[model samples]
Target: MAQNLMVCQFCETSNETKYKCANCDLILCEGCKIKIHTKIKKTEVHQVLDLKEFSNLSASETIRHLDLKDIQCSIHNAEHCIIYCEDCKLLLCAVCLLESHRTHNLTKIDEMYHRKVKELQELDSKLCEELPFYADLEKELKQIKSESEIKEIITKQRENIITELDRLWVPREEEISRQLKDTAEYCDALKRNKAQNEETFQSHNATAIFTASGKLDKDLPTRPANTISKQKILFSETRIPEDTKEVFGSVLTDPKCKITGSFTLNTEDSIYKIKTFENNTNILSLTKKSTIKSFELKHSKCNTTSI
Candidate 1:
């Protein structure tokens, strides 16, 4: 069997390589070596080597023999690049060299290509060295971002709690204020009537006392219907596990009213007047027969005695 020869670069069909053009970096068959390689423009000075000999040479040796004089200038398309300008970092033809880069540092194109390759290798090494530090910095930044998000969530929850508390309590506060005003007004009226009766009694006139007593009975203030009740608004906190995923703790409110004390009055007559004092610690009652009774709350039970 025949050995697997390298394919010709020019025709891309023949599998018999005989020569290699160092300048164009192409492998050619025997027929294409003479016909095709010669047809290309500016190949008169290109060093064509035997395929086996070219393969035997080191990479640096092959590059040294490679001709770059035929490389076209980008700006002056028809002219060929002869040198590379170190300052401008561009390939220049003769005309370009005279026009703009006359005083700039210049070198051969192959020398500059080697220098550029070395610089790229150094830059790649530096990037590899700093990659771990950048990765750690990115991780730290992400942790900070996560902490900030949690703080924002907690702050929003706090604001919502305050807003809801205000919504629930504002109307109740207004109701309490109205009850207080009404109670004050009722107390003032009673004081006026008492003052009038006391003045009448101090006059030492029996007729005046009899006439003022009927007026005082008519002017007596009635008790308010809607009295302010004692209220205790409490927030019962819920304990959360340390490992729980929840961001904040929760609270509960008891809706049912608690009965603190109870009383029983054994009165056969109808009890008309009832009054409580000192947070429901003491109570007074008056019946239609002018009978008075007093009670005191002790240990959640009521004890009464007649007066």
Candidate 2:
């Protein structure tokens, strides 16, 4: 098993290895150890040991032998990195140390490398612990966003309902306007006839007064019939059901209650004030003539009382 684990690093073909080169960090078979490894320039001084001796050394002893002399400085290309600056977290050559890191805390490069590796391990462990919390937070944010989108859709639906209501009421509004215009024209005709009759009454000549009075009496306009009462247009509001999910969407709570009914007071004067109570079952109204009436809605019928 030991022979299978160690392969000749120089030739990369021999599975059997009996020797190790610590300086070159290679496993060697006897043939490559003498023939190939020895032929390499400056490898003559490299420490070659027996496999048993190499296995006896500790990990620290092996690390201590690692040469950092050839590590080139990034700023000074020709210089080798000799130390590490803790404050700047950078590897520095002699020139870099003198130029910028003169007052900074410095340490051996190998020691700083081990310290940085330990810090990275700690940070990785902490990140692993916090990952689940961040994941839950992300889910909460997404849920809030989804709720906002649903609310926006509901708002758009409400606007569409209002627009449709306006469209449907156009013809009814036009009919009311036409009736008002006709009533105004009829009143204007009556006023003109009254003015003509008054001028004839104040005339000096008796013949003029007698002739104007007979013509005015024959051509006098009669009051138009009250056709508006027969063609009355009334609009009733729609009530919101207990659950609005079918029409709108899921609501947080039940909507406020509403009542729908109509009643007529026996006063010819216009209604000046109106108040409702008891969930709109009872209504109190005041007319322009200072007359008050109370109305109660029951069984789809209005019961009126004079006050």
Candidate 3:
């Protein structure tokens, strides 16, 4: 009986038919497949095309043969050259000198292979070291972006707080000012009413027999009481009075933070205070440094004052 024969694709070994590049018509053994064909520069571009796809090409396109006769030098037309320039990828005869390569240093293909392999290995090692740095940079950038986003959100929130506080202050301030003006007008009205009563009393007294016996001065009014009653009295619900603190209502601190107002008062008993605006809460209290002097009566009557 005859033994069955099988060819190797890479080493031309007929020992086994385990691996084959059928499209390229090459027989390869396992060792030669990895060590020889796969490592070669030219065959590296050739893929393992399926037989069906390869068969679709015409015969002229499928097969490529390098004719040694065509390997003549363009300069001298010499044949059978042993030397070749791997960097330039060209054949060179003995007559071809090194000066023709310009500044390029000429070397054998085997020397180039060793040099290239060593350099490629070193470059691969260096690239491996720098890969970690690239990953670290990417991570840092992501973290920085995340922190910036958070800060932006916080800033927006602070702006909103300021806006809200401003809204609350506008109308409230207008109303308070209006009330103050109305209070002043009411005080004036009271003064006028008292003046009218005093005039009526004086007229009645003049008609009477003995109205001003004690006041001999004829310049004084017939009635004993003055024509006008000053209403200067002001009372606070809390003994702790308000301050320039009220003006601070128009003034604002960080609305996102807390607000406190400070003030000084000139009165019979001087008062100094720092108060919280939100709850009308007093933070401090103090008394006058000197005695308060009394002033002459005005067109109105009421003595105590509060601010």
Candidate 4:
């Protein structure tokens, strides 16, 4: 009844409405809706709606579509697909298995779907467990980098100290050498002065002898000859000062700076001995003029110094 007679809600034209607008739900007639109503004063904003009703559709028949399968296989006219054959690349029914998929690998679509779902869940769990390990590894690497930076700074500081010490070392050594040379020269000058004074006294004594002989004294005057042997100046046994050596013996005698006296054997023994030291000890012994073929140093040992 709604589809047989058409009525325009805007113009009230019974059985004369043909075109209707679906958006605004307004019906329209040919003469009054378009020609007459388009010219109306206040109806310019009205749109139209088109309606269609099917008489064969019932309430129960519309709900029956819920139980029906909308999709069908083109090969089988009435069968629903639940498995896909990979070898043949086709859908198959349960009864068609022995005929078409006997020798092929058959897979259920539902099974594949569930397997994919479970795989995604396992991947998520693995990623969660690995996250903390990756973060800890990154943190350890950062700490290692920080420690290396600190070591580099310490090395640079040590290099700076070595440079400054080297600068002070050269001139100080030259001054010590100059003092030693001056002490030797002073000892030489004193010996020369003593010889000159002795010569003068001897000359006066000879003159007196000549005077006494010419005067014809009965007693002959005897003169003692001046015998003076040059005394050798001995260097200090300890290179460092006496008080300093006693106070710093433990530190200095570390065998590094100690210079021991040389010992040599007679022709029968023909042995030369050199002591071991700390700094440059191995190098010095390797090139020393000693009879021993090879030497091994034993520190913290209690005994006399041996050849």
RMSD each, Å:
41.7, 39.7, 42.8, 49.2
Deviation in Å, model 2, residue 169 alpha carbon: 58
lDDT, candidate 3, at 280? 40
Per-residue error at 192 for model 2, in Å? 99
Worst 10 residues of 2 by lDDT: 226-235
Between prediction 2 and prediction 4, the one with superior TM-score is 2
For residues 231-257, write the lDDT of model 2, one tens digit per residue: 212223344675654453222322334
Q: Which numbered prediction scores highest in TM-score against the true structure? A: 2
Worst 10 residues of 3 by lDDT: 226-235
Clashing pairs in 1: none
Instruction: Sort by TM-score, best first.
Output: 2, 1, 3, 4
Which sections of candidate 3 miss by over 4 Å?
1-105, 156-307
| lDDT (tens digit, per residue) of candidate 1 on 253-299 | 33657575675555455557778767764545555455556776566
Candidate 1: regions farther than 4 A off: 1-6, 9-14, 30-44, 49-66, 107-114, 117-307
Enumerate residue pairs that collide in model 2. Answer: none
How many residue-pair clashes does candidate 2 contain?
Answer: 0
Residue 197 local lDDT, model 3: 30
Question: How high is each candidate's TM-score?
Answer: 0.30, 0.32, 0.26, 0.23
- Predicted structure 1: lDDT: 0.57
lDDT of 4 by residue, 5-89 (tens): 7576666756677655322335667665667666766445434322332112222122222212222454676776556576775
